[model samples]
Target chain A: MYVDVILNQPASRDYRVYIDQLETLHFDTKVLIVTNTTVASLHLETLQKKIEAKELYSVILPDGEQYKNMQSLNLILNACFEHRLDRKSLLIAFGGGVIGDMTGFAASIYQRGIDFIQIPTTLLSQVDASVGGKTGINNSYGKNLIGSFWQPRAVYCESVFLKTLPKREFSAGVAEMIKMAVTFDKAFFEWLETHDLEDEAHLKEAIAKSIAIKARVVALDETEQGIRAVLNYGHTFAHVIENQTHYTTFLHGEAVAIGMVMANILAQKLTFLNADEALRIVTLLEHYDLPTHYRIENVEAFYDAFFLDKKSEHAVIKFILAQGIGGYEISRNIPKEVVLEALKEANA
Target chain B: MYVDVILNQPASRDYRVYIDQLETLHFDTKVLIVTNTTVASLHLETLQKKIEAKELYSVILPDGEQYKNMQSLNLILNACFEHRLDRKSLLIAFGGGVIGDMTGFAASIYQRGIDFIQIPTTLLSQVDASVGGKTGINNSYGKNLIGSFWQPRAVYCESVFLKTLPKREFSAGVAEMIKMAVTFDKAFFEWLETHDLEDEAHLKEAIAKSIAIKARVVALDETEQGIRAVLNYGHTFAHVIENQTHYTTFLHGEAVAIGMVMANILAQKLTFLNADEALRIVTLLEHYDLPTHYRIENVEAFYDAFFLDKKSEHAVIKFILAQGIGGYEISRNIPKEVVLEALKEANA
Candidate 1:
């Protein structure tokens, strides 16, 4: 039987950044912040000031996508061990998706399971990764193929952290915002069409709307069994690009930006989406300076990667094709010819 | 809101246990069996006979408690990467508790998560580890410091594997059996008093009873929020003892044997149990020749280890003390002095 896991809403907190002060979010024990060098340089002090606990410690790891593997997981576990962090000690995932996923996973595994709070500092993380409780590290097999549906005790999405984010990074974050809009909220989709993401007010509103959309989807389908897959609208194609490029070429949002465009073309070809709607998506993505297409090196090799993806399994590719801008249908046993045609359009 | 996650039991399957039949469980995908050299030598041929996957492989790790750590976890993860186990493949954990814990943990993080089955080859593992979804490796801080509550897709328990087990190992499994009876089933506990564990019929009944108790408890409290902590009737002291002895000095069950004896004394002192009931427990453990005590070289150091235990936090240690043979209570805020006194008596 499926379970409806509650998603706790973030509480109100003043937007401030420092190296380390003492405030009480009211946890009963020590708190350990799991982050890396990059985040430590920028916001660790700020986070330290905001969180008050009986005891507080920081474990800084070497930062990079390359380190998002089992070795990094070991490092996180080691920190928890060394600190004697028990089931009572709270783990704060203080970086972006990689840190959030790894730290949440560490908390999930530590002492069988423990409480963890998400203090997501990246746009991609605040709107997407922080909500799902999808904790895992990437392996050679594929991204997020191994993970647990372990949610956090609370999520502190302080938009203040976005101040240091690069323009491209902010736009990449917008990609997921747009995906959520396209798959679930047409009003939000329309809002994105008219607003410039560079406007911080508009971006905050978009992030909130996007997260709410994701929250609704997740509340209905916590385990990604049905409606939750809508969140993966562009991710299927995006994961291949991310893997093929060794996850270095495209910021996750950038890959999804191109992936969304490719998916739109496939939707249009199959009459799942109108040409005008597809064009509108492409136009908006281009406005953000997000790549809308990529060169395909080898068709079959690229096609082979889809089978390796966690989404498509048992030789059945379950494609999330749009029924225009606001609706999606998960199609299964999708023929290779149709997928190949979509791949060609993606390359084009 | 508290969410109860219940696992629906799948129909059991009959599996062939041969040292050479590992391939039959796979379907054209890579298969990796994370086991130690001891189990590999004893039953690899039997496993090999069943494995007919596209790629069949094994990584025989160093056999023993010392190897159940982060370095070994890294080794297991590295083997997965080196062997190139894909997303669709499977990992079979084919040893006792250490193997099961490490392998289950490795699978949990291998790609985020992967499918794995437990082929528990020891009585301790077959009756205990195989039933709970508790998968983890130990750390310097304490046992099972890093792990997940990840349930296996299936568990294959073949009583035939026990034939090769040493006498001490067989007795260790019975300790868990005794634990199950003491906590949940009073009638079962009384029956155990008369039945010899060496008899095959009684052994099978005991194993089934132990599994059923664990399965019920786990089904009710998968993440150990409430009543499930009662299952750790002796683990509070067991972890401390195991930690002090460096885990190599005794099998987990043997430590638990001594721990149960210590807990009984504590229970009697707390007025929750009578000495008569405690003595009956001592007599049963003695019948199996399981160690009932260990000298505490340093009482302060042993006490320090309890704080490092995953179950302990701050100054409070949660102890599972029995009211009598069939009644249990999870006592938190257990004073160190009380625990020390029990330890002193057990040692004497």
Candidate 2:
């Protein structure tokens, strides 16, 4: 399946993502494949043999979310400079979320922006990160505090790469799909509930559906000023969870799994979602062996941390609640008592 | 003297640059003014008195081009985070080029990009830097190696701020105007030759003409992939000079002054510019008390430095040369001997 991610950004018309084999993306411009050490060791030679470019170079970065920093970003950039990849050159992000984010960011900044493709090897990036054009590095203060909404020229998703993907990370990727389905497509959510994603055909359809939903939302609101916030579904809580755990404790999608349960509890408290409907979402997450609960260390501390959230404003927190399936309601200033109640329900 | 800079970038629509007094923009969005210590100490209170925003906050950064880095950029981001600035929040670049660049970069990355306004306080920024959407911070590798092309919401170019600008800095700004005139508008170049920029009215006109020309080119090519390369008339040589001198020996425009002269020499050697026309541009630069020559320490080393330039590719330096005024030509692979001859001519 070829998914066309059409972003009306300057000079970027549109690009297609081939959700199968990595086709020959023939380019006259110089090409640099920015991948992690693990991906490079596993798949670099194969990619080099397949991709036809004037010059193909590989920049191997250290594997893991922790290595996604300014220091690691420079490694990719220095390679571009060394390779003399001009403004017209292309950068191929050939790993997971961390690699895609860093490579996209490097392309956005290099010579004040260039073209880059997303060859998302991990399921998390293919379904979410690689499609949205949200690219940046995490600072000491938070995750993705500094990034740009730079879309990729194309994205190639080959499930073969997921064969070696860690069990925890693969499960984490499913959480994001469940996120999209629950918030935007009731039929898709139902399909996921009945379907075994472990089956190759089921997994590919889920990935394609998730990307299409994401592509539509981003097209409508690329900057996330309005309806796009709906796509965040559980991201507000996920950011907090990621922060509280120092980002080392959970893969982003893993945090999202727990975040969805917390959001569902909040939805029930706000009377936006019935208890039974919310429970269905929780059961789906657990079926995949994903965590569906997290205990707040301190209620007051957890509540106070909301202000520090990237979405919070002037002491008012903006919440994205699922309005049953295939719908979302954005509420500003959900009463402190309601939030506290939701936190109580969230307590493991 | 109200000049409108219309850009056709993704979400960046048309923005006005008030060369007159700072108007009350009356933004309902939260406004965070990003300025330097010097500019803030001089005019923060005055700006506070003039501008009316819903919630006005200021982030005062350290002063100097040397401080324009990711660390300084973080200072702005940290302030945004501390203030809990949301998606609609606007950042004001409230100083010269350094402030505008870093502030614009911060806004571009904050929440994956937000809106920013440029309030250029220095003559250099008013004429050149403020109009373009080019924003970034300097890194260990080089100046502006890490940045994004994020345009501002608007620009307020009040010459009143330049009253406090130092003499050397003021002259440097004149060099940028001379740069614009020499490359794109011959009529403006002729007007500049006869007029005295020291006189306030003439200076204002020169500034306006420079901005209009810049705005026109930028509108056509927000990304410098084609005719926009002509705008880099002297920038290639200037970067090499700035690098060799450790960026401390000369102001940006001062180096540009010398760079333009070097480019003219190369153009004359290629017979692209008549001797008299090239000399006229050189003479006009000198009239503004800008440098007309530089001594090459080592021609081979200076030529080698060209490859490191962001504009260079495949070891073939793309030289933007003067093609009599109002016209310029981009030549790739200009013979090394022709470059060597130009360097020897540059050596005083």
Best model number under DockQ: 2
- Per-residue alpha-carbon lDDT of candidate 1 for residues B107-208, written as tens digits (9 for 90 to 100): 887666777878889989977887767888766665676788677766777676788899999989889888888988899899999999789878777777
Q: Estimate each model's TM-score.
A: 0.86, 0.91
Off by over 4 Å in 1: A1-24, A243-249, A297-318, A331-348, B1-32, B47-59, B74-90, B298-305, B308-310, B329-344
Name model 2 segments beyond 4 Å from true. Answer: A24-29, A37-42, A52-55, A81-84, A241-251, A269-271, A296-301, A345-348, B10-12, B23-31, B37-41, B52-63, B243-249, B297-301, B345-348
Query: Against the true structure, candidate 1 has what lDDT?
Result: 0.78
Global lDDT scores for all candidate models: 0.78, 0.86
Top-lDDT candidate index: 2
Q: Look at candidate 2 and give me any clashing residue pairs.
A: none
lDDT (tens digit, per residue) of candidate 2 on B29-137: 7889999999999999989887788889998988999999878987898888887787789999999999999999989888788899898999999988998789988
